[model samples]
Target: MQKSVVVLAVLAALAVLSSAARAATDAPAELDLLLRGGTVYTGDSNEPVVGDVGIVGDRIVFAGRKAPAQFSARRTIDATGMVVAPGFIDAHTHANADLHSTDPRKRLNIPFLTQGVTTAVIGNDGFGGFDIAAQTQRLRSAPVGTNVAMYVGFGPVRIDQLGEANRAPTPEQLDAMRQHVSRAMCDGALGLSTGLFYPPQNFSKTEEVIELAKVAARHGGLYDSHIRDESMYNIGLKGSIEEVIRIGHEARLPVHVAHIKALGVDVQGQSGDIIRRIEKERAAGLDITADHYPWTASSTRFSAALVPPWAVDGGREAMLKRFDDAAVQERLRTGMRENLRLRGGPETILFSAGSTKYVGKTLADVAKASSADPVDAAIAVLRDGDLMIASFNQSDEDVRAFMKRPWVMTSSDSSLGHPRAYGTFARKYDQYVVKEHTISLGQFIRSSSSLTADTLGLKQRGHLRPGYYADVVVFDPARYAAKATYTQPALLSEGVVTVLVNGRLAVDAGKPTGVGAGQPLLRTPKAGSCT
Candidate 1:
């Protein structure tokens, strides 16, 4: 009896241990989502293959041919016949400026999301806000549909330190500007951006830009510029590119040209010249890259396109006063005539916004109707608030040449007047990749996603790999294309059936899910750097 009792107790203990082991083995891996049977574009690789991607919380937990056997997901998607890729990162945008709109639709950024863009780098062309911390925090205050990153603008910083003054900064003022740049870098600015093509920043000489860029360089940040001129505005096309190269050489930081293009009648076929200079500098081990919109036409304010930089020296109020000054009117007219000629004439400058009567009319048409010179008509239009223009001045050959270059990535340079604001990525894919065959599919994916992320130093959100942020896009290859035009700038794109920002669904089944999962992307300063 004693022997039997001991055997029974041993069996009971064995049973208890077996139950505990089973319980531990059966515990769920708890993945948030799983995407199966999609042709994945890994972004880094040149070819895509069938694969599965798994997400847990805000990170991609698995991305390979085989799914994790242990994990049980709350949501599973059959992405068969779709292209699963990293969501696009727009390298240049003004989206951050519109985040404060009371309209929820604008804040949702559906135009961006539907095109498969997951993030936008704002404050381009030296118009980024002054307080980096405040702007970043404001994004958090009211969540946006797309992730936001910023560059501290030289224009705003210069204007803030010295109010639209048309001269070089004094030593004391230079110190103050440096302090501002440093503060912005500390507050998570990616780098310094200059709109040297615009006022205030236009007043700053190349040496001044180099000095400001050095502050960003110390923090391991980039130097991005709408160069001193894309055409014959001030320094001319080749000279502007040389200035950028000089800045990169002197500052010892990566220099990115915002909206790389050969604009106007004088610079029509100069894309090759620009490319050669960049390639030569790159071979010398200086980092230089550029972003280009797919469109041949460029968009901006009419004042920016037609008005002489000297006339806008003291800001809008001063500009209006100059318009009225009888003494300066003739000079202004002469300057405007020259500027108009550079922009491929008034017929190329189509008004897109600010006046209903002229919305779809070219400056030539408006000028004809008013029975006035196109230059005077342009100046008159500027008097009635800011006018947005679509200047169709570039050559298809120039655009294609630039697009074929590897260093040139895709960007929107998006704003209110242009269809590019709503359709850049989709248009690039549809026209360049699918329709025109200007570049391969893999190259298109890289330019839109990983390359842009790499260029901007967005560390965790570019590739569809394990341990990266789960910002992903799944689109039907056959159905994806841009629908927005200059007139219908708000139309959403098709084909991006689903999008996730930080593992949360922002778009589902080709519709917005009303989840604002985007967060501010701050730069990770390289080791031994100030940021």
Candidate 2:
């Protein structure tokens, strides 16, 4: 009788197993993850809501209701009473460090993910990012909280080949640069990045830009530029737009205007013209897109501000020597006047980086404290210490108008640019979308997530859809806000409670779980790869 009962139990277990197999064949297993009960903002404009998002392995398995019980995992997160959206993508960043410092506690990163940034495009402003073999190796084994895609920086290539001398490349030199660009792209550069506002790259003629961009095009690369001038003053807004459009037309590649803004007091309201020009370019069939941080202030080194381009003509050491020369100092003043009248006024220059003592103070404030002239204070600061400074120059009206443009994907334009670095996403969602109601939450998420992903051609990310990476964020709209201010710029954003990247728990209950599961945006092998 005992044997008969055991036999019956085995038969029942077999039936249950058969039923489970049937369910697996019919629907996805319950899932390794099941983030349900939240209002899923999928970042898909067409169908935004989903009953649940389920994950199997590293991929999103299901994104609908009534998931099967087959998905059994060791853990699950209940995202109830929150908005589940795609993780934020910072389209522009500068995370170049000469040294990683080799100390975990002394590590300099990990604040990005805390602010809902799952991925960041590092290497901008013609910075030195060409060490792809090294950077790729580093990030491949990195412990950072987010994914990073790098661009082959033009300045790094120029600096490595030719010191920061202002001149166009020779034919052989141009070819060499192309080879470097191609190899970097092969090594995994998503695109070619240029900073027309900086030295070396700024000296490259429009034709030179097109030549490199064509190389980028041959490698399925996009051209992103910090244009010659963003302000509608002297250089004129159309000249810069013309340059990007010219690049697109010549290279037959997509061109992105990095951090589109109208600077300077006189040109503050000319954002509409910039938008019209961009639209015209887009209408003409050249793939033209732009990214802008949801902030008024743009940050850069103070040298770029007070000191003229001529002073920075050679490199760092050259500038220090020039600073000590009285005759050179006089020339520097002439250039500073041009920059002030051209770049923006003193009110726009906010001290974001450098000594903690100078963090919140502006050039005017520094002058007041030092009992010196404002421009002289700027020069002294550069000469004395690191000149990391933020320019609070953009117009709020221009910012709002630019944000409303559908083609304009939002970016931080920041890696360590104070409040914007830590609080751009939250600031937009809270102040603009939630608190102020300038844009809807769905629209905000779309621009922050899906649009950016689509803009970059990074498939399977930037959305909470089935078969996509489970890079997700959960936050309460009412509670969502950025706490980092100009005074306390290091503060993290408030109200985002959960962030997940690649189906793993990266952020649990508003804190990092210390799991870094980021993946590179795979560069597809196409005709472009061959170039």
Candidate 3:
């Protein structure tokens, strides 16, 4: 009897082993890459789970608790003690400046890649080109380092139809403008972007924008705007918010606020009010959202910061002509003085780019050195050339308030001489997520990735789900931080250990791989819209 029992046990054990072998053989083939032992945020959850993520070709094959024992990979990254999440998508950027460069190195987009941004939206603040197909073709021919999506800019379209004119467009011109927007939408533009805060776009009335926005809406595109006023410049911030809501309602399209902020002392501490207004609009069923960078200072042309919009109506030469007009001088100065006061004071504006002599100085410093009034010094600087200034206008309280909102996403609004170009994501993580605990890591990742993607209609990206694109980021949370500052704007971020764009490593072991794996992401127009 004992001998019989032993034989039965031995046979059962062999049967179990054979079943396990069959299961292993039936499992999917080896993965192309495996990220082992990391805290993973799937971009859909506000909580993280410690797990392994497996990829095959250009798609994620597994992204949960330990990838099965049967799964293997050709390349494996020991992601121990790291945070693995979907690669961040920048809601707004000026990366097109470099992406369009002839030099391959410039197209590498190392600044954004090092910050773990695998995709960036271009043509923001109303500057995208009208020819979406031409732009896509150029990007395809000379690939860039990060995926590029574009908006059909209101500024370019309006300028093309009306040459810096402040008056309303003629009916023929309006129809022509509508055709331009429709063609761009059919050619894969995400939406219409307008920097209404800047001239000549500021010259466009709300009704004109609504007409164009309607064209984009018919083709299933959204409206993105740098609202007409972020401060008390024209209509107040609240009025601008209402304007955006009205546009959404009138045009019947979603509206996105770009780099939303309570700029200037006049609008300081009004972020709460702005948030309430946005929420009210949202509750009223208008599709409205906004993006913000993680800095108190806002960057823009020196002239845009101080010069009255009416003075810049025609163009540079026209504006220069006004500067020489004795009749306009006192009025210009008066307007500038009020603008300067609204933006804190002369000391709060730092000249970031343009004249070498003034690049590192404040408006106050320049005024003092020139022995002139601050306004006069500003005019002198503008007359020479418009410099980029970093105006320290927002309060931390307002910044945090905007950030805490679930509707607000992250953006760089990147431009030359601004640290945000290199470090917006990292800075947000370091300051808001890590040190201050203003938001959880998962919240930060979600806002920077999936939220932006969903809002902008970027398909098949920004998540860590099976069958999703393998654009992933692995970083040392403890070490991940922004190294760039206003003075050192070009310094790269630190601690982004590995980055993959389209399943290829763009940054490996914290060093860029020099692989331009980026592709132009063109939105397909609604069915039959192209035809």
Candidate 4:
């Protein structure tokens, strides 16, 4: 009886094992999409791996190595001979103009999508709106083409309480500003962004900035700044760097420098010193990072570039009043003349907006055409209306220096009339990686994608890994190049063959699919902080 029972138990165990084997053989192998045979940069390494990526729903199911034979894909893209990478993330941009536009086509963000930029950080240079919740709601109501992250701008917060006055805030005004920043943090801002280089903000003292930064720190946000000086404007570049570092130390939050550059001739060779200082600070355990645009020319308002901040103290009307005063005229012109010199002369400043006659002309060209002094021509253009200029003041050496740094990621301070808006990523790839060989393709991809995402605290969005969002780009490296020029600033880049945003095809065969698949990426406030 015992022998018979043991034999029966053995038979039952065999039966159970056979059933499990059958179940394994019958398990489904299906995927929503497959990208096959591409040289993939997973954004975590400097080496490219040839592999297939499988996706289902909005997340990657598999990356690297071939998918199993049992898995069948609904659609497979033949990515042979192409480079597959995590979709590029623009660390800084002014694409909010299009993102907020009433027109659906503008909201498509075709320019950015074509360049393989799947995400854009808005509210840069301290011009971001205070009502982040309203902005998020607007994005929900009207979808856009690329994902957007927002910063609570220092400009708006200060201007909300203090008008465009060039004075320090009072104690009560300071408290109000802190409350505004705190509210914005609760509304899902990634950080507090300040354009200390710009007026009104430049007028603010360092202590005031630290106080506001503390509010963001308490709610787990960072501090992103267009530093007080990139050149010898007021505080030298080194001084400005120290200021932001001090803010990070005192406020206890990560700090990011926007459009990092040694602008103008005065600070051209200072990149080495700047890098050392930043590296030292990083070693000391402060979270410090920066972003850079490839172009040598930086864009900004014509007035902001040349006019003395004091002249614009009260606002445009006051600046105009100063312009009309003969007593102030000599002082203003002297300041303007020196400022123009510091920017490498009128020939380097090209007007890109606000006047049809001067839109395509340099300050030198405009002055020559009008038969007036360059400074006078600049003033005349300003009086007509504030114009945007592509100021070609950065040195190639300094640009290359900053580009190679691991801590410095890529960005496009995108604005109208600047080719950077349409072609920053493409241009960087073509000039720095493909042509100059300043950085390897893997380095470029990693910096533009994962490094930026990590610095900004964006989770699970920058790597081509299993369980990550399927925001990916496949491009022909040989053919990828920027077509936009300084004159024709809106031309779309070439060579991005396919783009997937949140697992949906936003671009196919180099054309925008008009798919508004973008979602507003909101940073969740620290636990219990919002309440």
Give the Cα-based TM-score of candidate 3 against the true structure: 0.95
The residue-by-residue lDDT of candidate 1 on 153-218, one tens digit each, is 998889887899798889999989898898888888999999998887899888888888999999
Q: Candidate 4 on 1-531: residue-level lDDT in tens?
A: 653343344334334545446345644556778999999899989998888988877777667767655567889999889999999999999999899999999998998999899999999889998799999999989989999999999999999888899888889999999888989899999999999989889899999999999999999999999999999878899999999999999999999999999988898899999999999999999999999999999999999999988889978999999999998888899999888988999999998866897899898998998999998888888889998999999999999999999999999999999999999999999999999999999989998999999889888899998767889999999999999999999899999999999989999988899999998888888888879
Q: Between candidates 2 and 3, name the one with more favorable TM-score.
A: 3
Q: What is the TM-score of each candidate against the true structure?
A: 0.93, 0.90, 0.95, 0.95
RMSD values for the candidates in order, in angstroms, are 7.7, 6.1, 7.4, 7.0
Q: How much lDDT does each candidate structure score?
A: 0.86, 0.75, 0.90, 0.90
The digit string of per-residue lDDT tens for model 2 on 113-221 reads 7778788887777674677778777766655567777888888887766778987777888888888888887887878899988786777788988888888788787
